[model samples]
Target chain A: MSRKKGFWRSSVWSLSLLAVLAGCGSNAASDSNGAAGGTATNAAGSDSEKEPVVLKLTTWNPISQTVVDKFQEKYPYITIEHDKVYDQFREIIRTRIVSKSDMDMLWLFPNQVAEFSKEDVLMDITGSPWLDNYLEAAVKLGTVDGKTYGVPYNSQPIVMFYNKTLFGELGLEIPQTWDELLAVSEQIKGSGTAPMVIGSKDGWATQFITTAQFGLYQHDNPDVFAQVASGEKKWTDPEFSTYFDGMKELADKGYLLENSVGLSYDQVAQVFKEGKAAMWPMGEWGYSENFDADFSAFELGAFPIPVNRGDQPLVTSLVSDNLLVGVSWSKHQEEIKLFMEFVADPEIAKIWSDETKQAVTVKGGTSETYSPLASSLQPLVDASEAQIFPSMTSSIEPVMFPIFQQILLKQDVDTSKLLEQLQAAQNKDI
Target chain B: MKFMNFRNYIMFILPALLIYLLFFAGPIFSGLYYGFTDWNGFSFKADWVGLENFREAFRDPLLLTALKNMLILSVVVIVLQHSFSILLAVLLDQKLKGIVWMRAVIFFPVILNTVVIGYVWSYMYAPMVGFLPKFFDAIGLHGLAALDWLGDPSLAIYAIALVMVWQYTGYSMMIYLAGLQSVSGEIYEAASIDGAGPWNKFWRVTLPLLIPSVIVNTVLSVIGCMKMFEHVFIMTQGGPANSTQTFGIMIYQYAFKTSQMGYGTAMAMILSVMILAVTYVQIKLLSRMEVAN
Candidate 1:
């Protein structure tokens, strides 16, 4: 009888706890509106009159945390809590957006910015005085339907990291053209180093390089994108054949790692860092480590990939480390503007650039004193002809990423098949 | 005399009946109702979609791949697992020394969480940087001869299946051991007096008595294998081109990832039908074997 009474008492307690939790949740939503309004009211105050407004930021780069900490010290009244989620960063941000939960600031890719900007979930920063400080291509990527959605910070373009030691042994200069690249591969193979360590396991690395190879069109033909977007030119055009044949040539010649199809980028990177390969095709993010690591003791040099017609020399890349800060449909306009002005500071960009060993997209933020690899990468930046938007963040991303994945798996994969799949996916949304 | 007491029997069964109705039957019937409507798991309203979600699931290639994986997994686990368990039980029943300790060792993997086991094995198969491949190299295998086990599509599913077999064989052994205990010692003694060989005695006497345990083990293994999710998910995430994906993974993709709750329910309904059909057939076959004996 006592045990039965105890069970009844425990059940009543659980029921009350559930009721209390439900009440707290509803109350918290109301409190959030008051808090956001209060923050807007106090934005113009002196350092002491302002209560600390702590905003939660989710970003990808490790260096962004350093940038946030420095920003916090300068403006003590505006505290920022930053967290980094590496693998599933996009998934977390997407979930929050769909749920209409809180997110004050976030980092976005070209595709993500394009998608969200279209959806009107971002603050329009275009025509602002600070917009003049950013690169034209970077600004264009952040703009969708005549409204700027994000402040572009850095850009990472695909470059070939060739072994200078192997080049010296084979008496070859760094390849200036695709023909020379293949020629150098044969020379390196004869000299006893693996020609290149291309890992296609995760599938994204292949897309980055292949997209770079196709960047020449943006400069040569301004109408190409408008045409492609309108579905005028097919993916099966002759240019695609050249790209597919080139990828197949590399695979057939065994220039890539034998187990690359089965290995991830991280594993392949270890092999490159360990000096088992002559060259690695990766972005500038790995530059600081390449220069500092004792194992990568050989001379490291980067060169812009050559176009088919070498004279045109068009270079393109996706925006890197872009911060897309927006007023939530729930936030007051004044609060978002103040936050945007704070993130746009040159000092913040400087601190971020120094820590991340990346270039700042803003004027007066690029530094020459960082390292040799960053200095040599100036041409790739200068050649920023275009930024091919990612499709996943937009209606197209879920469709495009998988189709591109199949293309990278084998060269024989038909381009027509991918185009058809995309057309079908677009029809579904319609 | 019995009719008056039978009134008391109704009182005895009433509490359990109420609990089952509340916990199991109520939710199951509710799920059937919700399965026909488009619900995102939250919201005061749900739109009815009729049989459209089910038709889409039937047409999806990913869902088809998942179904194939489930069938393959069920067959592999039910056959290989039962054979190994019975073999182990027979060896232990020979009255060997340290038999008590041996039984405990055999049952060790059965108690471990499948997620933990999957992760440990994946690291062990981590190709370039993993212990197994390094050990193989140390023992003198060179180049591509040292296989990348989990990364290769052809071998990835088998590696997961092998892990499942190792985990459940001990469980099946324990059930067989219990059944072995009930087989009269007098039958074995009588077989020996009739000059029956050891193999003959196992086939004629022991095998007949172990039939019931076989049925139980098969049903359990099949049901468990058909619902296999956590281990394969943690280890592979259906990589190397969706080679290890199961029906449960597909259901999760529709429900949470894609936010298609109604479609997920439709898939779950199909799964229920498949499980029921497969189980009914097995039980019927097992009963027929018992009747023949």
Candidate 2:
């Protein structure tokens, strides 16, 4: 019995020691890999050419397989492993960074550039030659503190997708001003059809409405967001509150889809596709081939959300999407740069634009085969200005979504109080 | 022999203890450490902010709203789940045809993945095209049909709580069933001989004896509901104006979404303390009740 007990005790202790050693061994291995990566970054060009490299690209956005195949064909030594993480993308990326995972490239949003760069997770690509090929506004989206960290991929403006068949049936021409929009909405509502679909349940969807208003607001006061950030202006001021009030008016007048707060973004698209509503306020991706909805049931037409300015051509609010950034810790810096140059190529950008149906940020990258629905928005896109909403660039962006949701959900919501909440969130962030 | 047995016992538990210390205890202690700092998650520079995060958390209207919602959900889940579970346990405990199959049917939802259940309930509660609204419309109850189950700010949390009860009541029922099975049949016979009616016997004998099960069920339900995330996250994402937001969702939003890891950790520590304190008081009171009964 003593011998048996001794054996058991020895075995258990040995197993525990093994577990500890295994953990330490893995850590040591990780440390060595990190050291190697750091060295390789300094000695990249020559070392990268001879040694075959596999780059790990992580993105929440869908990348075209054809684009990947073309890139691989051009650079045979470089193998790209694309990992798509849709749900909890930011959280997962943060975890990967903390774990020192070998993520070579990342598809990020423009809003995330400052935050990620501040964390020192992004590689500075300010001096990259291919950056000159992008539009000035596109390049500016990924630049923080006068240093570029990401390559802007697409310029997707939030536009209104109206059922052309329904619009024709209702005798509603595209509204050019806010008042005109309200009048058209009222007419559509009077005909027993919901005027618009806003998926307030998915809180982020509410940004489309709010950002459109901000887009118009920024046209006149370009430094409005900067003033708000610096405490020169308050969110509760009429300058900001009026836009929210505009949003509330649409809800108050029963113009938006009933029970829209119950619908997801995809569900609202489905609602629009089913002809349940006259207009769907969403990003340009809604009409793209990548969109889940089948719009064959109705003639789809899109227009920029009408600003208050009547005669002046509408300045569409263009938001940069799929901003590709190199992970700072990646071993294959040369390979990542090569991929960046490939994406920046106008021909490759055109292929990407054609496949994804987004307006690529590369100069001369717009696809010629745009459908009439996509083609209609070209004038607005040409006159578009990228406006950074103060809330989106700040830490208060998450809270802004809920505030927008509250405005849409509650008919009698106090816009001043909601804006006060925004001010408070901003103060806390500061 | 006693010394040898003690050594052997320590050895047996050594591996598990090492793992527990390494993973669970280590992370918790590290989390507590981080709670005192202003760590923005990705940055290695974490300046110590003392109790600032916790102090701000108290003033945070969103955190207060989340706490209120969590408490309401906990109470609703506990009451509804326990009542349904006790009733079902009693009903199914009786010797009847297909009682085993009936128990299995009741327990089926408990076995289903929470994500699957959340999605299923979401579809069922979805507006305009959902089963509940369509069913109500078909039955000539247009008013109920028009009611947005998961949308209306006043109704969303309760709607989620209903799903919680539906999924977890069976789990609680099994516990009560086990307690029922353990109760000797002779005790009921004695009660009957003493001229006790069904309700009298249940009140004086069955329920009091089932105190252990009640304690177990209540504690589990309270903790489970306090940590409610997957259901609310999957269904409404604490949306339609932050109505269904709980501590769990708020913690996640702060930690990951807003990049306030230190503040999120502080919130988490507060939640853990709250859970521990609540559970402690509950066990104390319930254990006293058990002893008295």
Candidate 3:
């Protein structure tokens, strides 16, 4: 063959192969895109007669699969496809809009709802029947500009989880004073168990400590948010430094699990679960998971994270559960409302409360079906003293985590300089 | 092969050229445009604010901090990675007993995924049950061991850069080995007859002959360090006060986490320009060296 003809023939073959490969990709995408505009309604309806509707719900929380199964059972016409996007929930759901994706529902916590609300991405579930059943705090979180956008699921109070067996063995009571807590930690460290397990490697886990510690001073100063808004209260204050100082003290005394910086949240949980550490600092959200584990000799208990002295008011930080947001762009609003209504039913809410080991906002959600660890904090939560977590999640978390890591690692960190840097980091306009 | 008609030539190259333009140039220009807007990533309705995002990025202290960290990572990685690779390539060029074992051992980390390598080093550098601290104390070198390899701001960048060096040195050694083998045996024989010793021959002959490989390896290492993110993300997360943060991590943080699409795009433009400038200089310098030698 002539050179020109050979080149032409080869190019055609190569281009054809590329075309075929590209076709395959497009075909696969369209097949998976069959998640919307398929909700069937029974206009000639009786109580039990309806066609099946597929609703896709994306979540970051590791929701129990059985809750979804039960929902499907109640509305036999509805099939819920649950996608656990994990840490990428926000990015994925947000981008789903660009693709004109068929996502119906999503779970968002705290700031995410507010962020998404700015874009008008979520449906305004105003006067949603489920709203009345929810706690006012949860309703407020999911609301922006007087319109409700989400339904609250469960709320968890962050606390210090202790091994009762270990505490009893060391002849220690739950220390109500910072000095007593230090002494207890010292004694525990001397006995060879690491006083606490806090994994700073993930950086986000350090916020658990910050939020919990901030609770020590939160009850007396419930209006700290106003101070923060007015720029009157800086994280570098001596009062705040006491928390950092406590972390430094733990690191200096080798009371922290020596390699906690390298461990992840789950790894530290395991260390505490295996009775290698005296306490695990975390929220009650993990109560069911941790308590279900093989702790042969010990029972899990919790207490308020102490502040300074015994006389000072003791408190804990309660972080409400993230709200379930409905996508405004979805074609399945009926199915979305149906699923949420099922969730708000008292029996179903109680089941969610039991499974998540967190207090549900449904009026009769708290029916005393909590694990011993969660029950310990229920009274404090009911008393309304457990204020919202004071730590700044957005502006401060990125910079503060590192400073907290250094303090907990016994490094010579200048809180003054670091807090200044954090303030500078927050000062950047997006 | 034969020459084609001009129309056929255009048709043949059109597919590949269009693919390149559609994927590569399209995104680059789009990102440049996004840099001038106030986009929150989630919203496509961007309010165009001319140069505001760039100005904000310029004033941001963390960007400067991350830029400094990227430079240090690039310098340290380029030096150690190339030196160690060259030494290994030269030594392994000599056929000795157990050469396969030594090469395999050195190249083992190269085959492992970077995520695995990062996690392994994290565990090794951990204060408890970590190999470094315990091994150091065992060898009476306790001062050299750190309790938290990633928690110390002063040491975190260097520590992460060294991990990159450890992982890629073997790959560079393989490239240098290929370059070394291409040099004829006659050149070394001629050097020996001229009364040149091994050290002198290496500096005079082996080094000069390996210019092509040096250029390739240096370019790769420079690009790798300039965009270093995964290791920092997996290990320190640019922490102990963002000491180990890099340009790539900053782009991801602003774009994805912070939802500041315009700010991230501005930083991304800066990083792309910086990479382009560095690569251009490197090509120019290497071409000069190639011509000089």
Per-residue CA lDDT of model 1 for A370-404, tens digit only, reads: 44676666765565454543333233433454444
Candidate 3 per-residue lDDT, tens place, A107-164, comes to 8766667667777667778997777887775676676668788866777777788888
Candidate 1 iRMS, in Å? 5.9
User: Model 1 Cα displacement at A79 (Å)?
Assistant: 2.6
- Which candidate number maximizes DockQ? 2
Off by over 4 Å in 3: A1-51, A98-100, A177-197, A213-263, A270-277, A285-292, A296-300, A308-313, A355-359, A366-372, A375-384, A388-393, A409-430, B1-4, B94-105, B134-146
- Cα-based RMSD of candidate 3: 5.0
Sort by DockQ, best first: what order? 2, 3, 1
Provide the global lDDT of candidate 2 against the true structure. Answer: 0.81
What order do you get sorting by TM-score, best first?
2, 3, 1
- Report per-candidate DockQ: 0.21, 0.58, 0.28
* Docking category of candidate 3: acceptable
Sort all candidates by lDDT, best to worst.
2, 3, 1
Q: What is the TM-score of chain B in candidate 3?
A: 0.92
**Which RMSD does model 2 reach against the true structure?**
3.3
Report the poorest 10 consecutive residues by lDDT, candidate 3 chain B: B1-10
